[model samples]
Target: MPDDTVCDMWEVQRGFDELGRPLRDITFCVVDLETTGASVKAGDRITEIGAVKVRGGEVLAEFQTFVDPGTPVPPEITALTGITDRLLYGAPRIESALPTFLEFAHGTVLVAHNAPFDTGFLKHACADAGWAWPKFEVVDTAVLARRVLSRDEAPNCRLGTLARLFQTETTPNHRALEDARATVEVLHGLFSRIGGLGVQTLEELQAYSAKVTDAQRRKRGLADRLPDKPGVYLFRDDRDRVLYVGMSRNLRRRVRTYFTSSEKRSKMGQMVNLAHHVQGIECATDTEAAIRELRLIAEHAPRFNRRSRRQRRLHYVVLTQEPWPRLSIVRRLPRGEPGIGPFGRKELALAALEAIQETFPVRTCTDRFGRVPTRSRCLAADLGTCLAPCEGSVTPETYAALIRRVSEAMTVGAVDVVDALSRRMTIESDLERFEVAATHRDRLSAFSTAAMRSSRLTSIRTCPELIAARRCDDGRWQVHVIRYGRLAAAGVIPVDASAPAYVEALRALAESTDERDERTTVEESETLLRWLESPGVRLVDVVGAWACPVIVDPGGPLVELAG
Candidate 1:
């Protein structure tokens, strides 16, 4: 202990105690550090450590030293620090410096700006000296500046800012001892602002410091992954448990979604944060990825999955929605359809969508217009591809046909869905809904590219299929079937396969209304295939022998039947 120290100002005995009796109080050491760099891990080394001990608000003793780090001082660091090599030419090493600083700070709390860096350096120094680290509390003035003082008064809580604000002409050098003394002055301004109550305790300051540091690090960009490709991914915890499952086409982009700045507040985000790690499965194509994703979601029943309803039991069924029996996706198993389970909801949706694309397919998903409308120009119309339903280039029934195919494709088929959409696109273009035509065109293009790249189709554009049933007030309940590649909805026909010219009459009925009905009756889908292969006697319902117009293969006029 130096008797001739500069910090001997705070030791006067006060007359008033808690009960108004003469009392003695301990000192607090306002400390500071000069370091070669910011980090404390391996390379950064401390240059100096200084402390000023004060008792009852008056300085009692001073401790300061320049430690000769074994490493050479970096020139850039020396420039910023203003502590050149010559300053430490014969200074004592950390081994000699730590014990002196420890003795000065022994009975008092240690206060500093961003105190962790200083305290951590001291701990390492103590560890080096074979002396056990001191068990003392710490206080960071930065925390107090934020919580107690008005932000405007301490806009920049740096030491220089506080010095200027307090009107203290104490020119701050990067010197450790000088900075320690300047901080004591800064402490006065800061304490005066807080009414000297020290709103935050030493432990609170350390916790605040750790939290702030972590928040800053999180802001610097290792927290999110953003890639735009189709793929499936998994979310796992630190223990390697697959806590959740997810799929995305853009592998990296999808993974980065969890870190969206807005998402952290969501419950899903809390779960994502809980997941300590993630892994991804890349697919060559998006459609495949979409299928795989659906399958995975169902299989895992992940806690954070977005689409999970009606994921299973996607089979051939009917909905009684509109007067014309507007086709809808069948959620429950009807007479047909295969097994469920295995995939997430996405794959389940795809499975039903595939069957409809293949069988009794027709346009189910149409514009607001029942018929395809005609318009002068839309984005699609302007591009010379679609007939805008809004302006009426497409007739209601015709538009309905196109929608039927899209709707049916949604419920059935395994073929590349883009193909069925392409076929519907061609139909729309032929009918003049150029805007819709353009979308179908784009969809077809994407499908063509996808089908080419991957050897699989989401759904194929199979011949449209038709389901006929008697109706009450509504028109004949015809469910455009998903017996082909993709499902499509079309106009209904109320008919009974009986009488002399039954087959001929039905063919005429299907053909006369073929503009819309032709999109129905996908006689080639597995459902129809199985149906046609059944042991029912083939009766030729001979009307006029009209050939199957769209049948490119060696077949005669499309026929209907009677016994």
Candidate 2:
């Protein structure tokens, strides 16, 4: 039988110090069991249970119990395990013994020679008793042995053979505690082998034993230099070309996954196979890390990063420059000209244009030079939809007043626009014009979305610098320094830091950042602005103030036709 003291003496030395709890710090519940038969589905029952709770190779506790089978112990089982009805007389039943064993094993990883057989029986017992089982990370010495030991060293990885080959003082004798003790020694031996391969944490140890290819295993060193923090990582090929870019709260853990069997995507497989090096860019906060990832993806245009590789299609609503300024949808805004959108879809942009046309009698004709048309008015003028500016019916000053209202509605998120549309819908419904009411409702939604976008864009465009902070869940303040809509600098300040310390950090961060405003695109600015406006963030300071004018609510009518 396995030596109780030998299992007690086997201690695993520590491994890499990157992320997560070190292997030695983890507690392991080494378990073993003897059953009435081989298969639980065939009505087999556990006869005895043995488990050793160890941390850092020191025995914390031990549990062993005989479970009354409530039936005859088969003669073959009695022969193999030497457990019989006589020995189990008046013993606690399987259901009764499980709770105490589970309590002993709580919050520790369960280790067994053949984990499936041992864990499966325990899971069935829990199900039978209707007890809620705690989530436990299970480790199989059988599986670990296969990865760590060669067939030449041990023809098979059964408990007896492994114990003998590893020269454990104890051997498996079909009894519970002796076999469990032997398995513990085997576990320590395998851990030592994997520790040399850089398996340092419980998570890493589990992931390393997965069905990773030899080629992938050879490249594990690629992740050795990565920092264990929230940041972005770039996977590069032997040619020094970026293959993929990803961000994670734990950079080393995430990068390691790319070369492990856990990466199941075909593209990911190809990327890892070609990857020769990994580069990490550490960030102060997860929010900053995410934003930096967006900026980097845009700049590098990595081939394997399918998303954010191309600019998102955006449309704008601009008032055409003419004596009679009329609303139009455009792809690009003219420099120095005011516009309403970077709308995500052409359909939404068109809807906003139609909404403005329906509410105001702005001229839609393309004519210029303030000349009255010799021809009769077009359909829009004939229907009083326009002021008939092409027919010289409206003065430029009067037309300019109407255009000004449109600008106010779009840029400042003027409440007048939404209120007007709401009232128009209500009036049309009261008049039983359901189709007109529906049109007004759709227009209001489009208009509100556009107004919100315009407000966000305008706030950052007007500011030379914006300093904002949000309290993180960890009690650190996430500080963002933005200049002209682009992220300039970001850092985390301790919530308990003094005023002077905070000011010095802000100054240092600002000085360290190089302005890349020229490379800032619409998406980059929008992403930063969206985060700034998110629920948790509080705007602490601003270099140049941003303000929006109050708009008088237009509640009287939906369609005001005056020119």
Candidate 3:
């Protein structure tokens, strides 16, 4: 095979083993191990283990025992397996049982309905006893069943049914011994159905499980598999190249969906064609999943995913970039030199001066040439809100002080910044910086803007912060924040950190902010608010928060729609 596109493991096997022609005579142990759950990594104790050996298609001997699970079995399991907490309360543990079973079945293949569940338990059991895990061949009876019967016709080819298929005459319950016997018979039936072709050795079968589309791969397993949960999954090629990286809320369901539903994912076609490899890392939380997926995508840049572009952006308040840095709004800070910059072109940078006109009724303006225009009580001035720079009610210096307050509200946050400002004003008055302190005194109203001056308002925080778009009941736009403030390690916060499911958070934030925007100090973003209240507004967690009505000279196109 060329180094081409890849198919899943089982798909790869069928490439050569059409119709599953066997390769050689093989000895197998029809085996069963009762464990706590699906994870072999988690210490799940097996209380019972059973094995029936067969060579040349004849019953050889049996190994069966109840090993104390080291922990009490829950009542539900006790009922299912009929292995009570008291039944094995004083029984010999696996350390004692394993040596005997290994010796009896040594050199033979291990077979089970779902081979991984049994083998994983056995491996863990062996490790707990401080023995090296001896690798061996395996045959999954479940896979064999799939090859022999149509699930729709047989509809119920369980171990018991498979025993009937072979006329092995065993109709056992959940006892490990009977199930093992049934599994052995199932394997025999499959072997006979294939014209008594020589079976692969135990080691070969286990290896083939990853590549073959035999009955074992298609049939449902006797053991319950892992649950569906949200997380990230990694798919690797035969050479261990990360073939694909994706995130999903339901981990098991999502992964299986790729294989089980041919229509849902055409990867099955690709998987079958190349018999590729895949494995997964499950994230504990959706946030973690999104973050991990994005990081992996960026790091490896898998062929299947579209790459994200790199751009320098700032969610900030901008004081004019020119002389004395006149105060105003900056919606989005642009890509520019990594410095206190007036980067990009200068026109868009100047448009922020229009904030004194378009947004706030606050009294402030610049001449058409974009300098502080002739003094007039800009609308804000007559309303007693602005210092009336035009009528000389407040001087250029005094007006600039107020602009700083607007900048803070637009940038850091309206409510939080206003609350801090109110406190700072009292402190400044006592210190006789009363004139200077009033810059922080303006009442929070309909709008404001932050000037991109210092890093003070945009410092990376200790915790993940949330910016939400929301719609008020009255159908107005609003934005809100739920900041857990500042985590220790500081760097450019990666945008891909959050998982896809987390996009739901915007609704919650919208509801929270809309309920309290009037009481809080931050001026909510109209765009965000409308987005929140819109029919399909979804909350998205990003590395940083941004407010609209941005005005910055990113050294790009003019009109200043962005910071």
Candidate 4:
């Protein structure tokens, strides 16, 4: 059994799996409001409330009322809405009418021609009346009309225009109940058009009506058959070339967003336009899904994906192997060599190298020296920046000592180096050399970040095999088999099965991994390390040693600098 704390963490839901209720089964409350003014913040109040609830094209109920605004209705409002102050003399005030309308619209999808206008006023009324507003899924028929109908089909998205387009029995006459009735007809007409594009669920309808392009809206059919499961998805062009790759806990919902206004990336819109099909590969665990995404992105080199494609170009700061060793940046780390990084950018690697040089007396010159010392010194040596090892002033043994210190600082905890740099920073501050102090602070930060990242990657990569399990929201256990920081296999333990036996069987069938194969990238290892440290993850088994070095103080200057 896991600890009480671990069991308590499992109560937090991971994600939703079920796709929303179907449109035919959902009840829609089409609502409209006549206001004293357009702006809710400028003391506008609802003068009339009207709504019609329908399910499967059948009217279930109707709610209509006139509210007393306590302020005189303007002549313009009377001319527009035909609502007079005398007619509202004996009507209920908004404080009394709001709760009654809310009760009628509760547990139904809220629909209106221009939803923001009506919904905004109602929200303000709820706030003013000291009543908590309910969370209702709002759908705007006007927005949906713009997405479904072109200018040739409908000149405008107004209630009267749509009522004429749909040829509804009730024409909008600026009256709340009549307009709400017309909007109900418009909503059904829009649904009929969207149904041809494979939108049968309320979630799909809401996404289809969002501010997406016509090209993207037409691509909604691509995500119709995707499963609601944890997996990787690929967007393929007409020629079957992958355009983009991604992963999510709910593949269908995540892929559907690519065609919705929620995806604001301009490049994604272009990709969706070019995509001819979408494919989903379901996985048993989210960890497996993440690793598969990284592998697929690396293998496919999809044009739209920006990360993990150039893993070969990652730079590392290494201490060269020579009689007079020096710090150098390389794309590939030599085997059996101690290094400090797998930085994504050369600039970051250079910064980490600079930080190491600033603290230790490591030589900065890029020269190949032999056992016989060359009697030559560079400008860095002349300025006392280097120990002048090439000039034969410093013996080979003394230089070796400096190399050991630098290597220890890179691999082990850099406690002494951090303390030395902190003291130097204080002295520079005392002398009022703020620019120099700032430079030192930045170098220290870069070094600390690189060291911490390398430690995390190394800890995961050095382990031969590791098994872990996390209980899902549905009471099933998601088991993962990881070898050398790569997902070897994955499975799920049923609620009635023993988790330990299931994990053991998975480990027996896991892929054989070679720790020295160089197939595991630094990003993949870091991804595994993060999963291993996340809440609710229980270690089931381990083969080799796994631990990270605690190098920096959590509340030290590094934290302050990061802030």
Displacement of residue 221 (Cα, Å) in model 3 is 29
* Tens digits of lDDT, candidate 1, 1-563: 13332122112232211211111243578898888888778667788877888655577888888888877788988998887789888988888777777877887878887777788888877777788987876667766556545578878778777777777646567877777887777776665654333212333223323333233224323224534445677777678766566665455534544543323436655566567667677653333354455656656666666554434432332333442233343444331222221222343334433333333333243334333333344565454444355566556677567555443333332233544555676788889899987765554433233222111111222223333221212222222222233232222232442222332243344422322222322222323333223443121221222111221113521121110
Q: How far is candidate 1 from the true structure (C-alpha RMSD, Å)?
A: 27.3
Instruction: Specify the highest-lDDT model's number.
Output: 4
lDDT-best of 1 and 3: 3
- Per-residue C-alpha lDDT of model 2 across residues 440-491, encoded as one tens digit per residue: 8887777666666666666676577777766665545667888777777787
Q: lDDT score of model 4?
A: 0.82
In each prediction, how many residue pairs overlap at the backbone (N, C-alpha, C within less than 3 A)?
Answer: 120, 4, 60, 0
Query: Positional deviation of 262 in candidate 3, in angstroms?
Result: 22
Alpha-carbon deviation at 117 in model 4, angstroms: 5.3
How are the candidates ranked when ordered by TM-score, highest leading? 4, 2, 3, 1
Cα TM-score of candidate 3: 0.33
User: Candidate 3, residues 1-563: lDDT per residue as tens digits?
Assistant: 12221111011111111122233456677888776555767766788888898888788898889888777787777777788877787778788888998888888767789777888788777777789877886667777566556776467756776676677766667888888877777777776654332223333233323333442244222111424454677666668777677777655544543443222335444543343555566653344455566667766777655432111222332445542234454544432212222223233334333333333334444433233445544555556544554454545566566656555444443443334444666788999997756554432111223233222223322114554333323233223333422111111111232222233343243222222122211111222233334563334344455343343336521122222
lDDT of 1 at 380: 51
> Per-residue lDDT for 1-563 in model 4, tens only?
35663343233333435666799999999999999999988888999999999999999999999999999999999999889999999999999999899999989999988899999999999999888889899999999899889899888888888889999999998888999999999899888998888677887887787777777767877888999898999999999999999999879878988988888898898899889999999988787888889989988999999874678778988889888889999998753477878888888888888888877777887667787767677888777768878778788899899898888777666665577677878999999999888877777777778777766666677788887777776666677888877878998775555555666788889989877857777767778778778887787667887665555566784321110
What are the lDDT figures for the candidates, one per model?
0.50, 0.77, 0.50, 0.82
TM-score of each: 0.33, 0.81, 0.33, 0.82
Give me the runs in candidate 1 sitting further than 4 Å from their true place. Answer: 1-26, 196-563
Better of 2 and 3 by lDDT: 2
Q: lDDT of candidate 1 vs native?
A: 0.50
